[model samples]
Target: MLIKKAVLDGIASGDIDLLFRTWDAERVHAGSTQRTAIGVLAVDAVEETDPAELTEEDARRGGYASLDALRHDAETRDGTLYRITLHLAGEDPRIALRAEIPRGRELTALRDRVLHMGDWAVPTLEMIAAQPGVRAPDLAAQAGREKRPFKASVRRLKELGLTESLAVGYRLSPRGKAVLSAVRRATASA
Candidate 1:
């Protein structure tokens, strides 16, 4: 479920508590948390709902100006209508993780993890570092890999706090730079 930046801001501000999506199946469950640029959102409930059953208040809580606007937007997608109740959970842990530079055991563990990602890891990091705001397809073409797998690889790096997604592309986080330096030194010695 992709929440828009505006809606995310609303969630963070406690002004929004509901989300409506059209999906073939439920994409999120009650208790599942989604990390967004703003922070983390905790899903409190997920239930099938009829558009007509949705009240104007529901629209407001969902960040829509009116029920008609909500219905209009929901109708644009094809799937079962699901009403999701949610709240801002907390800060995205990655925010903290991306800021911290690893050392000693942690550094070694992170380096090993990157090495296990195969030959593409270091090069990908270097490429992102070199061209911080390039589009993914362009980066993928430069790397001679398909866009999907390349994106997945980047996501893995992001999970490790070694990358930050930009509005258009990505850049190495502080942790990423530290890890990359450590990895380069270790590989050079080996």
Candidate 2:
């Protein structure tokens, strides 16, 4: 089920409102191209279904049933999510989605990196997670920096795969959530 790039981009970035708007626009603009029937149904289900549930059937049907369900599936199937995002982007893309880190040595390494980011990085990531749809300019204002530098700093977080860029701003990756939790637990116990 091929969804348009704008729609996938919106969903990945937690822009459900934008997604709805874009979906409706596409449905209205449904002129020449023969739309994929299942894709339309899946998006409709996402729009209509309250208390949505994911199932093997939904997977086979090949699209998300709801924004929550999509987020859940993204956490569980990060590679697939990433690939879909990349595919939607088309051509060589600068940014890509990433899978969460596995445990043991990699986790330990990441923890060390996180700890050594001079205290600000984790907190920044936490802030981004807390404000899901906030834009970069707003975040820069909050951080008391000009937008360009603040955006560059956020890009650094993206390089670590600890955060993702949305159409508007940013969200922590699943790995980011895990690292934040681990760090909190470690600090709390200490």
Put down candidate 1 lDDT per residue, 43-141, tens digits, no spaces.
999999988798999999999998999999888899899999999888899989999999999999999899888999999999998999999999999
Question: How many angstroms is residue 116 displaced in model 1 relative to the true structure, after the best TM-score fit?
Answer: 1.1
Q: How far does residue 105 in candidate 2 sit from its true spot (Å)?
A: 1.8
| TM-score versus the correct structure, for each prediction | 0.92, 0.48
Candidate with maximal lDDT: 1
Winning candidate number (TM-score): 1
Q: Taking the tens digit of each residue's C-alpha lDDT, what string does model 2 give over 127-160?
A: 8978977998888888777899788877777767
lDDT of each model, Cα atoms only? 0.93, 0.55
Off by over 4 Å in 1: 75-77
The pairs that clash in candidate 1 are none
TM-score of 2: 0.48
lDDT agreement of model 1 with the native: 0.93
Clashes of each: 0, 0
